[model samples]
Target: MQKHIYILLTILSAGVLMGCEGYLDQKPRKSLVVPETLDDLQALLDNAVIMNSNVPGLGLLASDDVFMEEAGWAGLFAEMEQQTYLWRRDGGFEVIGEWNGAYQKVFYSNVVLERLHEMEEVVSANERGRWMALKGAALFFRGSAFYDLVRIFAQAYQPGVNDSEMGIPLKLTARVTERPGRATLEETYKQIIGDLNQAIEFLPVTASSLNRPNKPVAESLLADLHLQLGNYSMARDLSSSLLQAGTLLDFNELNPEDPFPVPFLNSEVLFQSVMAVYSFTFSSLVQVNPILQASYAANDLRGRIFLNRQNPQVVTFKGSYCGNFDYFAGISLNELYLINSEARIRTGDVAGGMEVLNTLLEKRFEAGTFQPLEASSVATALAFVLMERRKELLFRPSRWYDLRRLNNDSEYATTLVREMGGNTYILAPGDNRYVFPIPQVEVDQGMKQNP
Candidate 1:
């Protein structure tokens, strides 16, 4: 069901309006017994473009959607795809999609959460759970959205850091009234962590195995957070738990003729993308990056997942499924567990970590070739884990986050900065361009854009 219908059902059952009131009053959420100009607030909900993500055109530009006559969404996220490391300043049309989707969805999530309890008691138990889960999920998403924005839009996270660094503003509980000032880097990270942690506590254990958030999702995120904060042990523990709990999508089971077909194509996926309601991302714009196609071995499962044959080169994206997906975004348990194992390795548990990583990878590669790790030191294992991460998580979104963490090494950072920007656009440690600018509209209304 669409997320909206779930909301509407919750509201209408709750009297969608307060009783003992004038017959003419119409408020979807009767929390306010005040007189209103409009009937139900459903109209507000209707006009609410709580974005799903990418906003189609945005995804096209960000990836490989070809809508315009001049530019296929190729050049926009071009740098990132090639690991050239791109950043946008001024929040141009280039980035407005992310800004708009994030803020708008945050507002929509706010509306639902704020009014969910006021609705009637007739809502079913599972329904209520789903509703609350959705609310928490939305909050988690917004928090993450902000986190991503801040991470790229501002400076990279430096451990034991000061609070004065630029971080995105926190916007919780919707924007019914005022704009908030920029939160401290510490404050923003706190909010993001807070929301995600709370989301882990509330949402269903299995939200989206592939693309969306859930309990495991929350845990995986926490694992990432702890890793970034240098809490290696905590990250290792979180990773272990998520991996043990979540199911893996066996790529070994790929049907050669139709790799991306239903059964959702991935067992690790808890839920698939749904467009009829609570909508936004579909695989509508996925062209395999040339780099990816070149990197994949002919025998690799990913090669089957991608398209090859660009002009003379054999590179492809989502193939026929590029613009077609019909379900909630999926969440992949497989990748999460692998990342967890990697974290374990980083924390000096080479044996334990390799056990987890090899289990997944053995199933990924052909029969008898999985190499078990017997690390001599933390550094070697950590290096191995990082390489494994790149090899395993090719097209996933996790790479962006991984890149942020790794971008700190002066040499690594400089190389990436040069690769993406070339000579003229050299990226500095404290440059604002490293992060996305807050939307002009938000800034006009007094939002503190990253410096």
Candidate 2:
């Protein structure tokens, strides 16, 4: 049954991916059908092949959080993976997983949104709620896809500069021939935020499965979007409200000795999605950075629960919420705690921030060994929260996104360094390399490439 589901999903994914251009062109295809019924539209989004959460796989491969030893690099890394590790941009530089995956999902979303209006007349009053929910889900998926795409393909959103800065092509319609040019960063974010806010109003408060977006999920995405936009007060308000009703998986309750300590769909997870596992997180050769591992206090359960140390220096990630080797990139309650904590500190609520951070830390540290963290000033508390955020969320998709946004602030900016093949490569804050070049194929077709 699982194999059949896999085959079906593959076909569905290919159908969308291959048909994107043709669909946009409004060309008739024998293999494709315009979603004429509400179920037909909902079916497109239901196919997790297109909609299940994904992060830029290359971003994970290139992040500073993990490293490969020289021996491991030679023995285990693939050509594309190695190039990314070295931050080489010449050949094999297109980050296609994110580009292709996001647009595929966006294509399906545009189809759904276009068809929903057609379904209004046929949708009975009893089915109106279902139809609305489907429309909201479509908008949520579309907005989320664009959000992920712009983060990878465009420069970080600098408010004053965004109006003139290049962004990904914004596709609002399902027409296949809609040769739209890239929108400015400001316009792109406005479209994303607008879609999400409308999605919030139409989506149900709760979804039966984590596979679908709900009111809380939309809110979480909005809160995170606000954070990246540097709207600290908005981020704090939304995340705090989310935490009030969210559930966290207590580390004390988990068995640290288990190979995969956290169960799939754990309590902390608000939505669950994993990036394509391309030997990055699962391989013995790729391990957590030694310094990052050491940053964890002795009694902190996150290190013990999330890592498997095969030897003195080799530590691979194991605490994925997916239960398999795949890296979980979806939002969770723990991240909300960190987000709210940082927002409070940035907004000058020093004691409130510490309280939130301490509340989360107490659960992560061992019982009776944990000391409540107290900070004398906002800076001290903010620093502690940022460090803990890094320590707690390694291998999750947030690291790259965090680095991009944090690079704007000198206090939080980082210069990523990789030492391999007897060479040292440095990526300084605000470097153009921070924004990946647009895929070569897309650019060859006249899409403007990032400089």
Model 2, 1-451: lDDT tens per residue? 1111111122344543333332223333444444556666667788875688555666766778888888777764466677777777876555665676787677778777766776677789998988989988989999998998898899999888666899888888766567677899999999999999999999998887888888889999999898888899999998888995467778999987887889888888887777765656557878888888888888998889887876767888888887767788787888889989999998999899889988898899888899988898887887899889888887887788888888988988999999887899898998888788776667766788899
After superposition, the stretches of candidate 2 with alpha carbons farther than 4 Å from their true spots are: 1-29
| lDDT digits (tens) for residues 236-288 of candidate 1 | 88777666554564556644346343244345554333222112123233334
Candidate 2 versus the native: TM-score? 0.93
**lDDT score for residue 193 of model 1:** 84
Segments of candidate 1 deviating more than 4 angstroms: 1-52, 55-94, 117-135, 206-213, 256-265, 271-299, 307-314, 319-330, 369-375, 410-414, 417-431
Name the lDDT of candidate 2: 0.79
The per-prediction CA RMSD against the true structure, in angstroms, equals: 8.8, 4.1
